[model samples]
Target: MSQMLALAILILVLFIGEAVSIRTKAWIPSIFVSGVLFLLGFWTFFPPEIVTLAGIPPAVAVMLIYLLITNMGTLLSLQELKEQWKTILIAISGILGIVAALFGIGTLLFDFQTVVVAIPPLVGGLVSALIMSEGAAAAGLPTLAVFAIVIYVVQGFAGYPLTSIMLKKEGKNLLEKFRNNELTAKQLPGEQSGTTEKTVREPRMFAKMPEKYNTDFFKFFRLALVGYLAYLTSVLLTPVVGISPFVLCLLFGVIARSIGFLERHPLQKANGFGFAIMGLLLFIFDGLKNATPSMMVEIMYPLIGCIVIGVAGMYIFSLIVGKLLKVSKEMAFAVSLTALYGFPADYIITVEVINSLTKDEQEREVLTSHMLPPMLVAGFITVTIVSVILAGIFVGFL
Candidate 1:
């Protein structure tokens, strides 16, 4: 679709979603609305030109990728990254383990010719996966593109449903805690804040994240350094030593964060997120330009399947994890669901419910604070795993 048309459709969807949200007191989960938008975009704006060098299409795509990357990087402010160190470490382990296990399993089951080559980017994200997939195909794996998109579809949608079931109990407990008073910066009604004077102020001050930062060339340097290191390692290992790039990126991010290198730099945080995302989109779009209609359709099935699995898995598993974390029942639900679907769905659902129940600004901020990081991390992890698995499956060397 044309870029403006695509953006218009997205805005319209958001408007409709918000309108329905007001009416139903939650995000409108009606499948029909999404379907209509899908049709409108597909029929009217299925973009043309295979790698256009001079056109609005190419420029728009480039801008989209740039914005995406910048936003992702900007999210990584030093203090915020520091606060997330422990969880990020855990996420690294899980992401690596998942990518390895899923790749091995897919290879063993299908033993496809050379899908392993595409695995890194799929796990990394579409753009990264696209790079890996293209490299694989150039090396003789024709199905790489299909696999990368398949992974995206799976991780994108599957996370929603699965997290819902998993966090059911956690959600309940979080509600109770909200009713109680321990999980707050300051106590609410019928509670005393004699010692929580400072606690209450922290939430107000830290609730909003600053979006702007000073320009620093070093920040971009660190980001490029990480990317280059990961790229070099992935290229050498995948071709020579037989390793995956997805793991390479995760390792690089971890190392960058661990040594007080990237974390110590204020500007590097944003640069890191932005580059990762933008580079990824550039890669994915490039792949899309090369793909035929047949290839797109071929990948659609897995997209549907994987998304279902991701959503179902999260919903079913979040409750168990949420309980362990001791979050409230509803809050637990919110956490688990948001774990992978961090885009905005969780906020839509939880905020709707919270607003209906109470106008407590403090409560809303607390819930958002506790859940956002985990959700973002979960998205990164899930996307990576899904990418790798698809890569393995796509190459047919399995």
Candidate 2:
């Protein structure tokens, strides 16, 4: 297929996917729909070079991811984080659950290579998947490397509906509480910071930036510069602090917001950034086109086993942590499931859940404010940060 035809097919499939997602209320997410469409399109077009066009570099993809997460930081409240530390803790516990479950049972049932490839996708997104696959390939386990990508393609189905259903359920519960006067916007546990009257000191981080260059473009450029600085800082500090660059991006984002370098609105308004994310999603789907049917069938048993066991572990750990944290099981389950599919889907499902359940403006606003932070943070901790770090370590073992 010509490049133009490939690009046109990509756009058309993406459009149809979005239409399906909306028409179905995201019971079938756009990414998954588009992924299937791409798989079928690949058979028809057989354009071997399509993946090349969609093949964004890891650094670029990570930067786009960092930009998204950093923007998320600007919307977060330190006080709310303090109040909802339990949710954050639960998210970490869920990751641990996957690690424990996958390594423990996976080693016993599957070969070492199978265990290695299966574990990474369970941990997070395409980055982790690719990391494990490359590691396996380097170790001369070509089949395992291929299986890793296959798992990455299939894992979204595991996460997408669980997130959608759980969020919808939670939203309905919140709506019921609201209608019965049992819950008030101000009384939402994590949102007490916004409800209370307290004076907070403003940190002028952007005081160094002259007001003359404060156009939207300049503001976004400044944000991107800070993100790059954060990346460089993470590289330097990785030797000392031993945290992933992505995690450091979160810290730098908060710092940027505090110092007045990053503004929430500019990120919220960054159309290009949003499109980049969509492109990344397409790139991930495009990878699935490379997987032959025989490969998927060959790994089917281990694939199902890994996902099933991983999910079981997540739920079990979530229940224990949720009880200790005083969070409900539904919320715990919802947050933990984010490990399966991160970011845009999590964000979209959370919004859909809230919108579907509430008609009141105040109720919707309160629910959104309360839900978004944990959902976003959960994805960040499990998918972007911890997963990559874990993949790095697990790959070493492989």
Candidate 3:
């Protein structure tokens, strides 16, 4: 009975935190709401005795995973991603490369403690969020709770400043492009081409293009379908293939786009925002499952080290990748920043930076469009893989 109330309290606080996010529009993102709740749980601020629970239930992760993957599939198919592939690729390359390198470094530096003494999660994907949470608790790694706290703290805090600064460079031109409805459309020169014909048939309504996109049920349903399918596949493969389903879902998203299973903006801005909220809640609750006073005190050093490496490394890697890819110098930087921090961070940062640079409508929107794909994709995959592992392991499964 008490546990049920504790869970309810978490929901209320997290919801309120999201409200704070909507109102402020500041660097402090909504994930912070969940992060703070997690901290409170670890600290025993509420009923206090709820802290006695050693790990999260398997059900928590399953629900979060399902929702997140659904969001990922829907988001991956959005118009924003279709338009800005290069920027995303370049930045992701840098992000993945750097994290991989760091993971190796962590393995060496931390003596390969498996859960605590290693770096598998650092560069693998955002699924590390779950792994960090669940793995730490279940493995009984030292300072497991602290590591979870730091991971989200870095994620939430880095999002704002980094994204704003990066996007600021794209400026007015990007905004004007959107305002003028100039999203650069190309059609088949001849009506005979199937590609051109399909695009024409689906000419989207500009009226609903504003941020609140997925109000319609069909769009939501499609996203949910794909996401759940990915989850199902992930589960099936877990026993047979012994691999994470998130990787498959991500591949599914990429393939879905490539094969033209979906080619529209499925993730309205509101939907993406909601998706982020759900992911973070799973991230926090599952992460706290194993956090006890004794464990948090053990491996504080590596926990601190990981956060420092993650936040700073992601930021620098994005810039380098952007330049190598030869995207608009401005666009690359903005996009790279988004890749580093994830969605809202990238959006907030891009808006601020763009507002500073140019009032040109076309360029501003272009820059914004460029930044969105990388951040959203990166956010979805990274959060999916890491958070899942974190939660699953802590639940004593996976």
Each candidate's lDDT (Cα)?
0.44, 0.73, 0.49
lDDT of 3 by residue, 57-144 (tens): 4454455454444444534444444555665565565455445555656556554443342233443334454456565666675454
| Highest-scoring model, TM-score | 2
Comparing 1 and 3 on TM-score, the stronger one: 3
The list of candidate 2 runs beyond 4 A from truth reads 1-5, 51-63, 186-213
Candidate 2 lDDT over 61-133, as tens digits, reads 6566767766666665555556667777888888788778887887798776677668767868888988998
Q: Cα deviation of 214 in candidate 1 (Å)?
A: 13
Which model is ahead, 1 or 2, in terms of lDDT? 2
Task: Order the candidate numbers by lDDT, best to worst.
Answer: 2, 3, 1
Who wins the lDDT comparison?
2
Model 2 lDDT, residue 142, Cα: 89
lDDT computed for candidate 3:
0.49
Residues 1-398, candidate 1: write the lDDT tens digits: 45555445444654564566456543343222332343344345544342232232454554433333323333334345456554444443334443454445444544343335433433345544555556555766566545654454334234433344333334345556866976753222112336352433211222242324323554555555665676678787765664455445545555554443443223334444433333333333333343445665776654444334333443344444545555434443444334333333433344444454345677655554554445454544444444445455554443
Clash counts for all predictions: 60, 2, 41
Which is the winner by lDDT between candidate 1 and candidate 3?
3
